[model samples]
Target: MLIPYDQLEPDTLTSLIEDFVSRDGTDNGDDTPQETRVLRVRHALSKGQAVIFFDLESQQCQLMPKHAVPKEFFD
Candidate 1:
């Protein structure tokens, strides 16, 4: 399911974005600060270039590029 970023609390959204940015192989030693990365993710969300996905089976959530999410998910 798609979770609108605006619907989440600011602190909860920040934590979720931080975790998404810090995931394995996400940085590749680029040395960017965590807050900076979080901002980037938020920007993507605002631009509709990225989405938050919640998996029903796993009850887990993560950020994904808009195109990376199947079209069926949106329907």
Candidate 2:
């Protein structure tokens, strides 16, 4: 269930980006990196084509084509 990053809706797209940045276990203080990076890499899926990366630790990327994540989870 792999999806190109561009296919995600705006909200879901934001969530996914946040998930990726946070998944690496790195924190950027009080700033939200996804807000900036999502805009930067939004075209990655269009020009270079980005693929969702999934592993044992996270389940969101593993389940594509399904909006399994709720907005509250991110809050």
Candidate 3:
């Protein structure tokens, strides 16, 4: 489901973004500071360039680029 970013608690949003940026291959060794990475994601979310999706089956949350969300997810 498409959960609006504004609905998430501040701490929850921060943690989610931190987890995403912490992934092994996520940054491609850019070595950006954690806060900077988190801010980048925050900006993307605010601008509609990215979204947070919740999978019904797995009950998992995923951070994905706006164009990359599968069509079925929206249905």
Q: Residue 49: error of model 3 in Å?
A: 0.3
Best candidate (score: TM-score): 1
Query: In model 2, where is the ten-residue run with the lowest total lDDT?
Result: 62-71
Q: Any runs in candidate 1 off by more than 4 Å, and if so which?
A: none
User: Which stretches of model 3 miss by more than 4 angstroms?
Assistant: 72-75
- CA displacement after TM-score superposition, residue 14 of candidate 1 (Å): 0.5
Put down candidate 1 lDDT per residue, 1-75, tens digits, no spaces: 999999999999999998888889999988999889988999999999999999999999999999999999888
> Against the true structure, what is each candidate's TM-score?
0.93, 0.44, 0.91
- The residue-by-residue lDDT of candidate 3 on 1-75, one tens digit each, is 988999999999999999999998998979789899999999999999999999899999989998999877667
lDDT string, candidate 2, 1-75, tens digits: 355565668788777766655655444563655666565555554564445545436654632222443434334
- In candidate 2 the C-alpha lDDT for residue 65 amounts to 21
In model 2, the runs with Cα more than 4 Å from the true position are 25-34, 53-59, 62-75
